[model samples]
Target chain A: MDEFGIIATYFAPLAGDGAFGLKDDAALLPARPGQDLVITTDTITEGVDFFAFDPSADIARKALRVNLSDLAAKGAAPAHYLLNLSLPHTITPDWLAGFAAGLAQDQQEFGISLLGGDTGATDGPLTIAVTAFGFVPQGKMVRRNGARIGDAVYVTGTIGDSGGGLAIFKREKHTLNDADRNALIARYRVPQPPVGFAEGLRAIAHASVDVSDGLIADLGHVASASGVRLVVEGERVPLSQPLRTLWGDHALSRAVAAGDDYQIAFTAPPGLEGPFTQIGRVEAGEGVGLIVDGKAVNVARPGYRHF
Target chain B: MDEFGIIATYFAPLAGDGAFGLKDDAALLPARPGQDLVITTDTITEGVDFFAFDPSADIARKALRVNLSDLAAKGAAPAHYLLNLSLPHTITPDWLAGFAAGLAQDQQEFGISLLGGDTGATDGPLTIAVTAFGFVPQGKMVRRNGARIGDAVYVTGTIGDSGGGLAIFKREKHTLNDADRNALIARYRVPQPPVGFAEGLRAIAHASVDVSDGLIADLGHVASASGVRLVVEGERVPLSQPLRTLWGDHALSRAVAAGDDYQIAFTAPPGLEGPFTQIGRVEAGEGVGLIVDGKAVNVARPGYRHF
Candidate 1:
C-alpha cells in the first residue's frame, strides 16, 4: 500500500472524533470553557532515543509515554496527540502494525486519542515526533518556578531504574539476577508515567518537573527557574533494590545523574508530603547541592545534555 | 553549548507570552470561549523535502509554511506552533542562527509565535516536525467533505509552479527568462501561503483543501470524502506565464497533476466566486474528471504519493 493506504488501514482508526476521519487538512479540538490547554512535542530517533533493534511497539509506547510524563508534571489531563512519523523504505507492515497497536494501547491507558498527523518517507532511520495536548483548569497548572525557601523537595517512585536498564542493555557489568535485569530493561523500554497523581500534584506541588534528564539536572531547572537552591539528601532518594545492591554508596549519585527515570520530582510544604518521598529542601540560593553522610558533595556529571 | 544552551540562545526568545520562557515541560495556550482549536503537523526531512544544499533559513521557512498552509485550507487563524528539530552532528551554530532568524521573520508575518518544542540529536538526516495550532469560530471549520452537486470549484493562485521549479533546480530543459526561472525556484524554496483570505473562505467555501499532493490527488480526497464527483476544466486551471509558455497544453496537465503547489482549491456556490478563479463544478458521481479540449481524460499520474 501507499502512504495513504497505510494510514487508512492502520492509523486512521486510532484517530478520535475530532480528527475528521483523517480527511481534513487539520483536526478540530473544541475549547472547553474555563480550561487551558498544555502542549508539548518530543521526537525519538532510532539509535539515539532508542536502540535500533528495540521492538516497534515498545518504541511507540516510549515515545508517547515520555510526552505524557511531561503533561503529568504540568498537572494536566491527557487530551489528544498528533503524530509525525518518518519511515525508511525498509519499514515493513509488521512493524507498522506493531507500532499502531502500541499507540492504541497507550491511548486507552492514558485517556488520550490521536488527533491528526502526517507521514513521510525518509532515507534515514525511523523517526517519530509526537505532539501531545492536555487540559488543566485555568491558571491551575503546576509550574517549575514556584518553589520557595523551606519547601520540602520530593520524588515519586524510584529513580535510576530506566537508566540502569539502559546500562544493562548495553551489557555493562552488574550483579543483578535475571528477574531484576528484566525489570530494569522493562522500565527502560516502557516507562510507568506517574499519571495517577497529576491532578493531586497540581493542587499541592509548589514546583514540579518530570525526571527525564536525571534527578539532579531536572531539580537544577527548578532551582534556576524558581531562583532558589535545592539541597538534596542523596541517601534519602529512593533507588530500586537491585540498583542499590549493585552500586551501594554510588547508587544515589548515579541515580541522581542518570537520565530516563520519568518520575515526578516536586517540592511542596513539609506538611503536604502525602504520597511522595521527601528527599530534599528548597533553599534561598542558586544551583543544586547533594548531601551525602551529612556533607555537601559536588556532582561531576549533572545529567545527560544532548547537543 | 548543549541542547538547552541552543534553545535558550536561538529558540527561546521566539516563544510567545504563554511559553513560560521556555522553561516548563509544556506551554500553556488558553482557549477562547466559543472557539475551536485547529491542529496540524508536517515533518520535513533533509534531501527528501529539500535539497541538502539549500539554505538553512529557507528550509526552516518551508517547514513552518507547509503546516501554515494546512491551517489556511481549514480557514483558521494562525495562533501558535511547536517545533521538533532533530539535528545531526554536522549542524553548525551559523545554521542554527539562520534557522531561528527565519522563524522569527515568519512569526511576525503570519501573526503567530513559537509555543514550545523539543530538540534532540539524530545520527541520520536533519528532520523537523512542526505542529501548528490555529483558531476558528466554534464548529465553523471549512472541511473537505461538504462539496455539493453543481457547486462551483475554485482555486487560488497558479498550480505546479513549485514542482516545476524543483524540476528546474535539477537542470531540466526549460526555455524561460532568468527572471521567470528565479521566480519558479523561489516558489519552490519559500511558499507564499494564501493566508490573508482564510476567514473569507470559511464564510463561503463549502469544502477546501491545500494543493500539496497535487491538484488531482487532493481534489480526489475532497470527492471521496464528500461522496461526489468533480468535473474540472483542464484549460481553466491557471498556469504561470513561464510555465504556460514553456509547456503549453502539456503544462496544464503536468501542473494539475504535480505536487507542492500550496494553492487552495475550494467549492462554493456560483454566486460566491469572489476573488478565486472558477475552474470547474461539482457533480453527483464519484471521483475526479479532467476535461481537455472538450474530451474527458484520465490522469495517469495523480500527484506524489509516498509509500
Candidate 2:
C-alpha cells in the first residue's frame, strides 16, 4: 500500500476525536470557552536525546513522557498532539509496527489522540518531534514568574534518581547495588511527570517548572524569570537511596544539579499549601544558591548541557 | 555560553517583533478578529531534504519558504514562526554568525519574528524544524474540498523547472550555458511561492493548493477531497524555457510529476477573473486524468516520492 493509504488505514482511525483529523490542511481543536490554550514542542534525536540501539519502546515512552511533562509544568491536562516522525532508511516494517504500538500505548495512557502531522524518510538518524496542546482555564495557569519571597520551595516526588539511573544504564564510572540500580534505571527509562499532582496544586502553588534538568538548574529558570532569590536548603534537597549508596561525596551536588528527573519543582507562600512537601524557601537575594547547614556551598556545576 | 545566553546574544536580539520574544514559557500572539489561524510545520534534514554543504542562508530561506507555501495554499498571510534548530558539534563561530544573519534577514522580509524554540547540538546531521502560523478571515479561507464539477482548472506561474534544476546541479552528466544554468539553478534553489496570488484569489477561487508536487498529483488531492474529477489539457501545462529545453519529448510527463515547483494550482468557474489562468475544466469522474486534443495520455507518475 502507499504511504497515504497506510496512514489512513492505521492512523486516521485514532484521530477521529480531533476537530480536524488528518483530513484538513491543519488540525483545529476548539478551545473550551474562557480557556487559554497551552502549546509545547520537544524533539528527540537519535544518539543525542535517545538511541535506536536501545529498547525502542523505552525510547518511545521517554519521548512521549518528556513532552507530557511539559504540559504538566503548566498544570494542564493532556488533550491532543501532533507528531512529526522521521525515520532512517534502515527502518524495517517490524520496527515501524513496534514504534506505532508504542505510540498507541502512550496515547492510551495519556488520553491524547494524534490530530495531524507529517511523516518522511530521511538518511539521517531517527528524529521525533511532538507538539502537545492542552486547555487551561483563564488566569489560572501557573507561570515561572509568580514566585514570591518567603514562599516555601516545594517539589513533588523525589529527584536525582533519574540522573543516577542514567549513570547506571550508561555503565559509566558509578557504583550502585541491584535494587538501587533497577530503581534508577526505571527513572531513566521513564520519568513520569506528576500530572495529577500538578493539577491538584493549580489553586495553591505560586509558580512551577518541571525538573527536566537538575533541581538547581531548573530553579534558576524560575528565579531568573520571577526576579527573586531561591535559597535551597541542603537538607531540603531530596536524595534517593541509590544516590546515597552511589556517590558518597558528590551525592549532594549530583542530586542538586543532575537533570532528566521529570518531577515538578514549585514554590508556594510560607504556610498556605494543600499539597507540596516543604523543601526550602524563596528569599530576598541575588540569583539562585544553596544553603547547606546554614552555609552557602559553591555550585561547581549547574546541570545537563544540551549543547 | 549556555543555551539561553546564546539565544539572548545572537538570536533573541534579532527577533524584535515576536509576540513574547524569548522571555515567556510560550509565545502568545493575538489572532486577528474575524480571522482564523493557519499553522503548519516541516523539518528539513541534511541529506534527505538538502545537501549538507549548501549555503546556510539558502537552506534557511528554503526552510522558511516551504512552511510559508503551506500557509499560502490556504490563502493566509504570514504572521509568525517557531524554529527548533539542531546542529552538529563541528560548527564554527563564523558559521553560527552567518546562520543567525540568514534567519534575521528572512524574519524581516516575512514580517515575522522567531518566537520561542529549542536549539541543541549533536552528532547527527543538521535538522531544522520550523512551524509557521498565518491568518485568514473565517469562512473566506480556501480549502482543498471546494472544487465543483464544471469549474475550470487554473495554475499560477511555471512548473517542471525545479526538478530540472536539481538534475543539472546534482548530476554532472548535464552541462548548461551560464544564463540558462542560472535560471534553472535559481528555480531549484528558491522556487517562488505565489503568496500574493493566493491572497488575490480569496474572492474568486473555489479551491486551491500550492503545487509543491506536480500538477496531476496535487490535482488528485483536490479530487479526493472534493469528490470531483479534473481533466488537464496536457499542452496547456505551463513550462519554463529551460524545462522545455531540458526534457524535450518527455517534458509533459516530467512537468506533471515533478515536485517542489511551489506554484499555486487552483480551480474556479470559467467566468471568474483575477489571480488565475485557465488550463482546463473539472469533469464528472472518479479520478483525475490528462487529455490532449481529446486523446487520453497514460502518464504513470504522480509527484516526487519522499521514500
lDDT of 2 by residue, A1-307 (tens): 4456556765676684532547655544432556656666777878666657756677777877777887787777777777677777787676666666777888888888887777777666788887766666765667788899889888877778887876776777455667888887788777778876657767677888888768888898889888898888888677777787876778888888888887888888776555456778888865788887799998876887876
lDDT of 1 by residue, B1-307 (tens): 7999999999999999789878899999997999999999888888767887888889989999998999999999998999998898889999999999999999999999999998988778899999888999999999999999989899998898898788887778568889888888888989877988799999899999999999999999999999999889988898899777656668988898888888899999875656578999999999999998899988996988876
Clashing pairs in 2: none
Q: Once model 2 is optimally superposed onto the true structure by TM-score, how far is the C-alpha of residue B38 displaced, in angstroms?
A: 2.0
> What lDDT tens digits, residue by residue, belong to model 2 across residues B1-307?
6567667777786654433456544444433456666767777777756776767777777778877877787788887777777778777666667778878788877777776677777567888888777777776668888999899999887878878777776773265667877787777766577766657877677888778766788888888888989889988888888777788888788888878877877888786666456878888876788897789887686886666
lDDT of 2 at A99: 69
State in Å the error of residue B266, model 2.
Answer: 2.2
Model 2 Cα shift for residue B82 (angstroms): 1.5
> Where does candidate 1 chain B have its weakest 10-residue lDDT segment?
B241-250
Every model's DockQ: 0.86, 0.38
- Model 2 lDDT on a 0 to 1 scale: 0.74
What 10-residue stretch in candidate 1 chain A is worst by lDDT? A244-253
Off by over 4 Å in 2: A1-6, A16-20, A30-33, A173-179, A246-249, A272-275, B14-19, B29-33, B172-174
- TM for every model, in the order presented, reads 0.98, 0.92
> Which sections of candidate 1 miss by over 4 Å?
none
